[model samples]
Target chain A: MRLSERELVSLIRRKLARSTASEGTIVGPGDDAAIIAPTPGEALALSTDAIVEDVHFRRRWATGFLLGLKSLLSSISDIFAMGARPRACLVSLGLSTWASPLFVEDLFEGMLKAAGRFGASIVGGNITRSNKLFIDMTVTGHLAPGNAITRAGAKVGDAIYVTGHLGGAALAAKHLFGGRIDRGRLAEVESFLRDDVAATPGDAQVELLSRFFAPPIRAEESSALAAAGICTSMIDISDGIGSDLREVCHESGVGAVIEIDSIPVFDRLPGSLAINRRDMLRLAISGGEDYELLFTVRQSDELRLQRLFQENDLCPITKIGRITPNSEGIVFLDNDGRPSEGFTGFDHFSTKEEGH
Target chain B: MRLSERELVSLIRRKLARSTASEGTIVGPGDDAAIIAPTPGEALALSTDAIVEDVHFRRRWATGFLLGLKSLLSSISDIFAMGARPRACLVSLGLSTWASPLFVEDLFEGMLKAAGRFGASIVGGNITRSNKLFIDMTVTGHLAPGNAITRAGAKVGDAIYVTGHLGGAALAAKHLFGGRIDRGRLAEVESFLRDDVAATPGDAQVELLSRFFAPPIRAEESSALAAAGICTSMIDISDGIGSDLREVCHESGVGAVIEIDSIPVFDRLPGSLAINRRDMLRLAISGGEDYELLFTVRQSDELRLQRLFQENDLCPITKIGRITPNSEGIVFLDNDGRPSEGFTGFDHFSTKEEGH
Candidate 1:
């Protein structure tokens, strides 16, 4: 299990060479740094995100392949959120001595698949020893100048919208973290994900694991939204709505008025937990890891945005709120028009440390 | 000092917003991704490197600033190794809950200083909670198309040369990790580094620590070498001559004959610890973290490369060996021309775990 760093790097290089090499690369893995040609007339978008073993995820909760896939996809999500197509990435991994070379191979295979599906070439990376396993990926993309949709453009009258299901990933995380899944079920789920035969739609455990294991892909819709010039501001819901909403509002100097009942809830949980409707609503509002695009568009462009989404087979968008003056202070009204209170953004990862 | 991730990110944004903003950035921090306008007609060189709490350096040995400075600079060295100018970087930090806000501030100050010195803008990054502190940096640089100096271009008759001192970083690391200094001296060294009063010329302790704390900056030298178009292949000496030479030789499908006596030695140790010449020679060849440039130039271009360095007052280069056909293998010869045996690459960081 004590594989040399050189061997791991060689393995990664071989996997990438066979699968992830793109034309713009002048030099790929095995160099001091990867050299890539920037597309003519396009700017580059850069982002970095890391998955520390216990911080972002627990290894036992998913297979190595699923873990690798999610780690790369999460970073790639940033590029898509910027309305850019991911082109290349550098993955820095810190593997403990207990990890097998096969684990490294499986991990890279997952990353290769994710990059290939998203069109990002595996360009360069570093391998080193650590007491804990961590995957830090930096992904870059091509974007036309001045075309990025940032989180600082929300206007007072713009309507707030989100693509895809909300709070499902968080709910999935809750079941796992809340210790609802037994060891036997965990093994089965991990095996399914490891074998990539995860299509058992009727199994509640597999269904729940899939949501956290694989958030819906949002790159195409983000590109479409940016191209249409309809979204005034955009952000991905990696953190729950409460946190993401605060970011946009704070940056844009705006407040928001959200309709609690209008917000689309991801209620596809695996089993009957007897959770009340109010609890489900709160989960929808506070859960993180959704990877869904949350954006705003001027009222006039709302129709055009809707038509564009309709034309393409993209995730449907829901109008959950509208931007308001900064003085209003992000007000949210319940279905009865009463102020919805005390639902703060829930950062599940930061709340507790898993005892290893 | 369990500051929220939000507050830490806000601190980073404020620091970067005040100091590191570059013109090409359409969006900087506080966004999902940073958008940078790639320099016209230039390819990009991307690299990542990380420093974990105990794996890379002990906090008692150096202040947060030096740790931050070295971490970022080491990554930037890769861009230079490719003969590119550092442009922008994303830093992903995993901080423990007990870490203070002041530590975070000082850390970024160190990174900002390095980035500022090397002309790289702090574009985007993520701050997350971790059981131990780690800083992972991904740096991108600009290089003219087809101008990158890769490690796969060396050929037979190519002269192997290196810039700057070698083995000094490993020697310094040995001193600190071997417990050469007590708590009082460790505190003093940390204070000296924390205050950035690093210019004590004659203090051996300070000098020894300086070598490890602040690696030699080689961006300008690398750019000059690449621009000169003399080096047939190049690599940064992060893992000492032995490991790096293996990289170039393996990639280029060639071998090398090195005169061990001719290799540059970073012999400016603070004071002698009764180390023999043979051991010092081995350390010089096997020690990692030198961050020097090990490269090859054709016999025909050697004079021109030497002339270019002399004209620019650049760090002097030494001709240590010549590339051989793969059948010759990578052989090292001592001053007596006898076959030098058993001086393999020394990977210090990967050798032992530092007990926290």
Candidate 2:
């Protein structure tokens, strides 16, 4: 049944109330605005992001719960990129007139679940009826005094690192949109993918597709890295490394030379998936929405940082490249140690057709 | 021309860079997340609100600048509703693929103007392509230690007060959206409304519409009220007094008895506007989007509060009602001291068609 704005708000309030308020929340939902107590000796980090239907994801391809989780995770990744612990989030949802109360409840449930996982509370939000569905989230976190890891801090000798494997989301997108599965059977296909991937580690297609639908956020890993004072510069790989790395380099007035052989591509796929090694490499380089933390560390601290990661049992960190002076520009070195070309990442307004 | 997300962001960054960063900003727009230094001995107040194309405003009836200003002002009003000083705002914009670069610029210009007017900085934002235009703004402010005046503070004998006149926005919306003017000539009509209303004191139609388009936010007045420790409860009249007052009463566990003749309705309106005295009173009681402050104060402190308001030279304050016990319920007394009936405020999902 259709729900009025007040009903939806009340529903959201009740659902969010289940997530216990954290220490920072002076006042939670149900007020004109939420009140949060400031953490002493800490600087607050704030980021806002939006996920629109059809632009970010097709409603038919994912459940409302997954969409809600992805929406919050995408914004939460920004806070982690700054090496801060997320304290609270405020969501602004734009729904179509035909949206059902069940849909709203499912969405809120997903959002609250994600918030609970991160130790952040859903403090407040607003809802408006629109022609299409969109979720805009604003996340606030705080870091120890003067410990923010900005994109502009990478030095010439800094080594580049990324958490977990990349390109799984891109590979998953290809299967979801490339007519491999019928829309009517999406739920069945999702179940099959989950079951098959878990049963067989080499089911590359299913594994990649599942990963795309529910990517893990690296909040704890990034926070640990920041606390250890290891990361010099950092950014979440939302836009592919090709685009994101260039952003870091541009901001830091430095360049990077990525060793192609060292790039970690998801490799457990069966031969039946039909993706060649070159295509996989391309996906790893330019595919977007990975949600993995890509950061740089001083070369001298590489071993120590690796030891720290081992001690903390954090996400496995991989070294894929090294920073260079801006004079050399961003380069991708092939197996022969020669600069390779034709690598480009996702651009919101690019006319070129995306592989996914 | 359609611009890439990168180009749009760079344009926004350049334009926003002109607004000098305040002392609270540690790192501003270019980063993944903005870092703000917390105010010591203050509690952070946060609110999020969104304005959609058709849901909030008609694109043809308003310029991008006005829409942007209204969007930010709406959220800023909430911060002020808590009697806090606005510190920063983050905007997330969703635009259609056909949106022009100039439209984006104009919108940002309006938002910046509003932010500057309230001493708040535009710290960060995100933009994406969607099916329609919408601006979701999240504002943050801070209140002095333990000074937040909440709705729960209102006592049984508290007197209800409002700033400036009410129902102007609703009356204006009636003329703007009714058959009085065509949508295509909105800009010209806006100018005419301003000039004609200014020249003639009784042009109720034009005066009401003008006020609707540009309702002044009562930030300074509410801040003064908070600083004085005089107000028992406070709220902004965005959803009209009927709904808003009920909210206060509900939260405070009290009821209210409104004196019909006490409402400060716009008096210079012409009879040609076709609103009778009773209808005007009804409009004043239930019309939405006035952006005025509705507050409650102890009857004993009424004279002192009036003196304090005069000393600050804030907006004109009017006593409109008294709080009663919850058992008494929300009552509206007519001029003859009889309980009036059949007054309902705006509901987002009501089947009844809105006049505006």
Candidate 3:
């Protein structure tokens, strides 16, 4: 049932109190403001992101728990991209009048789960009523003094790398939004997956959909990379590889030539999904919401970086390309080494509008 | 005059760049996240607040610039209440499709003005499209290590004080919303005031309206109090003195008795305003959005606190009440010194909905 604003706030405060305060939390929730003890000799990192209903996700496409998880993860990804360790988060939620208390509880549960996983605390937040649902989160992280890895540090001859495979989230979004698959078939698959029954041996589509619904935040992997001091530049692939790579290039005044064959794509889908190799490659290049770490490193450190990943048992790090001087722009080199076209990625306000 | 998302972001970034970065800002905007160096041995203070259209304000009630200023000020006031110095702010704006580029720019201009006024920089933010306008701001502040003044520090016999005269904002809101004066009268007064023509000698309504539209944030006064170690407990009067006083009492396990004659009320208004003393007292006690500082100090420090405020030329501080043992509860002693009933204050989701 819907609760009064005061009741809702009390409920949220109680739910959030379940999260143990970290060492840096001098004052946790329930005060005029939270006080966090600074990690001495470190610089603080701050980033904010918002997820609005229909703008970012539809309630029908995911559960409240998953939405909350994704909202916090998306904001944390920005901190991770900066090679910082997230310490605290402040969530500002705009709730619709129709929202039930249970729904809000589930949302907070998801957020707390994510925060606990990252070793951060939900220090403070505000909630207000609105016509639509929106969750705006601000995350604070920290790194060693003067040791932040920025998007503006990529250099010529740097090797490009990305953690984990891409395209799964895009493909899942396609199915959820009825891009190629019929709505009835998509519903059937979703229902089957939600029923908690074991999927058939060849049902990779369910796995893809799960990944899209609850994408992982690469905090551990990013921390390892940052601690190693190996990355020349870094960013999280929230807006697809092409768009994020362009950001790195534009910021660093460099270009890149990525080998299409070397770019990782989800390949376990059954043939029944009717997705061809070309479409898969296109999704990998242009689709967004992967939440993977993309970074550039000096060619000399490439081997050492790979060894570091292996030693830490971190996610697979793939060498996808090399940074070039600004003249070449960003190019996609096919298997035969010929530059290919149509490497555009998602833009929220592009002329050709695409649902996030 | 609507701008694309990218253009709007670029405009905001350019405007924010006018705010010089503090020494603690290691990396500013245009990166994955901004990096800040923490003051050594200090604790970080954080607060998030949002202003939602129709709920918190109406489009016709104030200009976009005023709305932006109020939003930032309200959040910063939380930091001030905690006896912290605001360092930076991250603003997340949800703009309706109908909002013009000029409207957004004016909003940002006001926010920047407020940030600059408090010596806090707009370090980073995010903007997204929504069905209604909402500005969610998160402010970061700092306090001397272990020196934060909390709402739970008040002791029995401590004297309570407020920074400025009250009821002006509440009176203004009443006039704007046709509480006693009709809408047409409010419109006429607003027009007269906006025209920059001289108000007739008895036009106290105009003065009240102006105060309501631009209530000041008591940052300087709060900082001075914090630095001097005078306040035992503190809070901002965003929800009126009664409500905020109740908060402090509840947190500190104390009770209070406020003298009706001692409570500051705006008395400069002429009879044309049509507000009686009873209504005026009610407004002062129950009206929200005053943005004044309500603090408690030990009885021994009261005179010194007043002298310090006067010496610093800070906002006028008035003694309003005295803290008592929790057994006494909170009482309002009328002019005749008799306890009064029905001292209810504003609650956003109370059964009796009060306009904010």
Residue pairs in collision within model 1: none
Superposed model 1: Cα runs more than 4 Å off? A182-204, A272-274, A348-356, B182-200, B272-274, B348-356
lDDT of all predictions: 0.80, 0.79, 0.80
Write the residue-wise lDDT of candidate 2 on A1-356 in tens digits: 26655677778888887778788677788778888898887889999999887677776676766567667877888999999988889999888765688878778776776677788889999887778888999999999868899999999989999998888777777766565645544554345533432232344555555566556688778878888898899999887888899889988999999998788877766455658777887887888778888999999999989998899898888999999999999999999999888887777666434333
Residue A61, model 3: lDDT of: 62
Ranking the candidates on DockQ from highest down gives 2, 1, 3
CA lDDT, candidate 3, residue A99? 66
CAPRI classification of candidate 3: medium
CAPRI docking class of candidate 2: medium
Each predicted complex: what DockQ?
0.66, 0.68, 0.62
Clashes of each: 0, 3, 0
Candidate 2, residue B266: how far the Cα is off, in Å: 3.2
State in Å the error of residue A209, model 1: 1.9
Give the candidates in order of TM-score, highest first.
1, 2, 3
Q: Is candidate 1 or candidate 2 better by DockQ?
A: 2
**Could you tell me which residue pairs clash in candidate 2?**
A204-A269, B172-B208, B172-B209
lDDT of 3 by residue, A46-129 (tens): 998888887787666656666777678778889999999888999988888656888888788778766777788899898877
**Top TM-score model:** 1
